[model samples]
Target chain A: MMGKHAQNRILAYSTPLVLIGILLVFVAAITLTGDKALGRMAAETLIRVVLVVGLWIFVGNSGVVSFGHAGYMAIGAYCSAWLTLKPQMKSLFLPDLPSWLAQAEWPVLPAAVASGLLAAFVALVSGATILRLSGIAASIATFAFLAIVNTVYSNWEGVTGATSSLVGLARYVDQWVALGWAAAAIIAANLYANSASGLALRATREDEAAASASGINMYRHRLLSLVVSGFFTGVSGALLGHSIGVLNPDSFYLGITFISLAMLVVGGIGSLSGAVVGVLSLSMMIEALVRFEQGISIGETQLALPSGAQEILIGIVMILVLILRPSGLMAGKELRMPRFAPRSPDYKTSNN
Target chain B: MTSLAQLFFDAASLGGIYAMAALGIALIFGVMNLVNFAHGEYIAFCVFALIVPSTEAVAVMFLGKAPAFLLIPVLLGLGAGAAVASEYVVFRHMRKATPVAMMISSFALGFVIQNALLAVYGGRPKAISLWPDLNTPVGVLGAQVPLLQLIVVLTTLLVVCALALLLKKTRLGLEMRAAAENFTMARLLGVRANVVITGAFALSGALAAAVALIMATQTGVADVRMGGQIMLVAFIATVIGGLGSLPGAVAAGFLIGGASVLLQAFLPLEVRPFRDAFLYTLVIACLLLRPQGLFAASSAKPRI
Candidate 1:
């Protein structure tokens, strides 16, 4: 048992250390690429890690599914984008915005936080109505919220561009900024996952009725996690939007929602490490495919499949995983050093 | 009144295709407890099937002089084969997993398929046009119905009736129903569970092929992106009616279809631009109130 525990400790640190090392190497490679595309990828990937880790907080702990995170990301992106782009443009694009919002141009950090807070507030409001339902109902409610948000984004022309918002926001999402935010997101999710309230959330997730009988406020715990996660997702949206330097309602469509979801599922649902692995691996694979097609062909045929076959392949992979290894690659296992955890008591260890 | 008839006819034609697609989706959900998010891609694959014979730029190899009715059966067979392969490769393995896993996998499958399709077909929505009038109307009940609409409605009715009879009178259909109701019990009775379940998926694929034809003819268009939009409607219709009930799904599909038409007719012009909003809101309301669905036999989370 001691040997197994020691092995677990070693295994945990090894992956992250390797990951961090790889991230640095990629960062170097991107810098070497001369162009900033690699840097943008790194920055966007960092943002993805943040959002996905936020997802891990609730999905991992509760084992319940929620689709509303994309909506939160949408809110965050537009909020920050709206702020930093310029007030005159906000007036032009977001004609329906309140007088105050129609005339505003904020800096990077404030705009980002405001976006997060806006999403978190929305989460707070939604959780009150939705958190009551357990399992599929809760999942469905989240989807409903997603649809409503998407509709609003699509139609609410005064603040949103309705279809297009070519905001000339300077590229503020440099690597340093993204790195700091990613660190914040990681720390926030990690702390929340292990906090006192986090424990209660986990308990509720395990057995809601039992957790309630044990005096855990199931709604409160789920809501708390959702609010925190919503903030991160919102920030991710802001950063991603800024990195791309263009924004549109269509950008956050169901397609992105599905890919984000697949990333979490394919990586390993409950683990932060899994989210990282999923994003990095999928991104690289896609990049390689794109690169491969651009470089050479197999005889007369392009060796390329169809346009959306990547999504199909992803679906096939997801289905295969569900059938063959339902728990995902990493399952619920955490990736952390032994130093991060408290030592088990002698009695507990000796008995085991 | 003339324009109104045309609009109704158009909506009905669209709805007919939607209903067929929904039925195909519901059929699999009935037995497997899966929503089959890859359904739209599978439908698109059928169009690809149609495209392949002529894709080689050789018209003579295909039915040059005659309408290639052979392509229809060939495509259905090929689609069924692909569907079964996907089921065996991916979904069959995860049938017993958690909902989160299942749902996520569906999303992944959708993404992979969409991107791959985009890579191959390009971003352009291809015109899968057909001969004669697809959208032109004929009068029915003071409102004009398109011939295509009539064909679609008639196709759905005939298919539904035939499927119902298959489920009732045929041994294979009965075995499928038995398996859907209680797999372990059916298994205990010496039924081959794997064969029956896979057969259900195969049947679903065949139906998808049939629906693809209606879809192609009704719209007078075919594009890879067509499945993404229509699949959601199938999902909403299936869930609102009842997850595993065929009759319920069909009823819901028509009801939702009628509702979408009615919304365009009755909704104030100010709200006319947001037709999808009204359509989805009704679906959401139906789902919220009838999570068990209007017609589903109450069962706990299906083992599948």
Candidate 2:
């Protein structure tokens, strides 16, 4: 009954809408349960959605695997901690902070925004040089960037508490708030994937020589994607900090980096839907594993996995998944409504 | 002047360890184009192999009690065995997958290995006394140098020379070199893919074992997480040396090690704690200056 263009437009928007809808339903389910632990799990899962989707903005489009987005998250997290913690608490804990940062305090939302902006600024600076290199070289450079960030943060006594955990952060990121951010991240990732810069970056990812030959500025587009990616990654860091109400440099190091990357790869590294789905599925599995580790009620007795069994099992599962589906579960395809008829040959390829 | 000599010995010893680690990584990457993240776990496994599995602060010697003549070869064999087993179990099936997938798999494999070790050994760092006598300092050029450090340098030199000879003179080496240059072409030329791949894994694993021995002797402490920092530095060296270039990997390993030591020694006390930050920044700068690496192999260049 509708024109083809209208249908196409709806289809284009449907992926993000479906993703957001899925998140909303997850949040509703958690809310209905009214259990604090379930609420915490949902919130953590949504935060990971933000982190992975942020990572996908650059990695999915540019085909550059980053081992450093966690660095941006660290930057955002500490930035929020510096801005939002009580002035009195900051003075006692981080006495070496400059007078301005020492005395100033801001609301949670603005502090998070500022944290994201700060992370974006760092990405812009670092990516300017890093994006010049292509492929694995770029990946290594991002890793170096992460190392630099970690080393600095771990040693910076006055600001980051120097390897000590910074506590007393406002735990404002409940499931609903996290749901809002996750939806925002999905929408942003969807927009970027369809944008000109994103398309150009994807072109380079497909074939750098051909993309350059076609006049795409690989450096600029890559940088833009990285900056946007850095922003959301930073916001996620802030969310993680607020959710747990603690911050540590070690938390944002290789563990989060690899785990988040694993989620992205498992979900399908190429599509927005993959990013969201990857986070949800992997997070749920992890939660279930944790519960099992705690002890499952069997008919006769409680059966519990060993304490570290979850990590080992998850790793094995990841390997099996990669072996079975190299391109990931979504295989780079966005979630879409089922189509009944074959498309006409003249129809333009739908944006994935 | 004595202090300067001491610094040189310190740098060289660290550099030697890093060189071995880098070579291990470079060998695998040359053959398979896979940056085996599990390489670090291999090192940890070898170190852990030297001790009885326990959560106690003081490690009970298992293999560490073996005589030097028997211990070295056994540990090296264990490293090689583990590497080859992983190749057969996990990596062999992934030959057709993209580099990214293989990389993630390697990381997952590492995660599994690390956690398995954690579950068995527990998380506490154990004091491991390998050869306490090796730490005795002897005067050299007016500077006292540890015997272990001198041995590390000599062992690194010996390994490099031996590997050079093997690579230049052996048939397996020729096949490996060919494969590193062009894997498909080497296959077409009748190179046995399994043999060459398995060989590289073996050599790489032995090198990891050597690094583990050196670290265990040097630090006198075996932690589950010990291999991670060295592995990261070695990975960066491997890239900086040119992804597939063996000699370059060794050189960059030494360079990074020397740079790190020098930075630690020369930087002001206030900035000393940030030495790794400075080192990594330099790594980024080096990468930016030469994206193809300081010693790029011909195969590293894109045909397009």
Candidate 3:
């Protein structure tokens, strides 16, 4: 039999292994059988995985519900567009861009990385002020941050094309690229979750007073996690812009914010596995509903629901799931191999 | 001088609507820690109740055609009933969940309600002419104020007075106040949890209806998204007013409204459209200055 230390090591490795396996299987199935539409759908789902995992990093570890992660995504998406769009097009559409940004043209990878760093930097600056507050106040402050970003992006005509769609972006992100990012997000989330800073943050999340008494600086830990969360969220946004081949400020608003939070909460907000699982399952359900909305032909009878019924049904389904499983499907537990299984420290009954 | 009078009237009327919306949000947050993201959809549902249920481009008034006497109560009742129904169907079952989970559930419910409205009413903003005469301007304190503005202001005062009376004089109100302070302690003192919670939902729902009527009358267009921006502002107001404090919410609502109007009036034409950006930055500054809010309730602080 393995020692406890050996088991703990196996448990750590196995959780991420299981997560990567799930994503790889998804990519393989879609690549082998799916057409272009399905390929696009797969790419969207993987990008959501990246986004949700990024969200899970801050929300899960700090226990702060941030409504502003999409703001970072907005920043990332626009920053990548600024860097990668043709110099000529930039001059035509974004005349007010700083001289350096207007003149620069970088490759996709560098642009995406830079996009993440830019977002991370913003998160750090914002968190310094916002993290001093706790609970609902912090949540509201993050929302204000999102609103500021959204309003500025939607109104700054010369640089962002204002409310109009920013078009002609190179569609550089595909299923393969999205899969890589999703995998990276999961690994990064798991690594951070197990790291010392992540542990300190989680401790603060559990009990702020006790954590602080033990010499943990709640503000600093929360800020670090927010930066990490913002970085990955920004990358996901870059990937999203590249995949859609266009950017619109409206796309980063309330709709995406709610949908991403729904996915994260549905899978479980407590574990890395939960974040990945939530996105995978919900994406599949949504796709299935979309296909159903389009109708499935059975023996010459095209059985179809009304066009918008899918959204209503999905909403009801989410409400039901929350009612039944208040802690979400995963309930904060990571997937582990049977022989090396250990009870999750976080898996206590909520004080409902 | 006339411009100043006009600005004050504009600010007050807009502030009245926002104050009502903020009260609805604060009432629910007081009893339950959950912030109902679906409150805006309640307003939308009420607006749509006025029109004939169809995907037609031009809306022929249904309930809206009724004279003011019949139309007002019916719409308010519908709003209250829908809110109560949502609480019973969705929120009641999820009381044991985390606040974050409950919030997402509320968002999902809002999504369902919005899409349902879309299915019945189509995705177009329909023009419904109800009480168009109310749009006529009347000279008030040297400002040409719309009659509807006076009505909105008066309606808000009436609601606030009525709510204060109900809370101060009635047993139900007493229970609600007790629950809002400390739900567990209230229950231990024999206060019925369900009754207080349900009552809060009903009142909140009614407030949402009041906002719907004012908004529909003011704009004359029933867009599915009409309530979203106001709801967001009210939500911010609820937070800035100190979470569970009713008076604080109303005050903050008016403050935000005044600020918004002032920004729009004073800012250069080029920056006028970016008014919300300036407003939200002030919100951030307010939070940093007083994280518990401008008027922090005793219970608003994080418990050590």
lDDT of 2 by residue, B86-178 (tens): 999999999999999999999999999999999999999999999899999999998999999999999999999999888999999999999
Per-residue CA lDDT of model 2 for A83-160, tens digit only, reads: 999999998889999989988789999999999999999999999888888899899999999999999999999888
Tell me the deviation in Å of residue A273 in model 3.
0.6
Instruction: Output the lDDT of residue B220, model 2.
Output: 92
Give me the displacement of residue A235 in model 2, in angstroms. Answer: 0.4
Positional deviation of B165 in candidate 3, in angstroms?
0.5
The better-scoring model by DockQ among 1 and 2 is 2
TM-score of each: 0.86, 0.97, 0.97
lDDT of 3 by residue, B48-148 (tens): 99999999999988999898888889988888899899999999998788888899999999999999999999999999887889999999888899999
| CAPRI-style docking class of model 1 based on DockQ | acceptable
Each model's lDDT comes to 0.72, 0.93, 0.91
Model 1 residue A346 lDDT score: 85
- Give the CAPRI class of candidate 2: high
Cα error, candidate 2, residue B114 (Å): 0.5
Residues B137-229 of candidate 1: C-alpha lDDT, one tens digit per residue: 677778767677787777787888988999999888898888767767788998787788788888888878877777766665546687777
Model 3 chain A weakest lDDT span, ten residues long? A343-352
Candidate scoring better on DockQ of 2 and 3: 2
Proportion of true contacts reproduced by candidate 3: 0.95
Task: Judging by TM-score, tell me the better candidate of 1 and 3.
Answer: 3
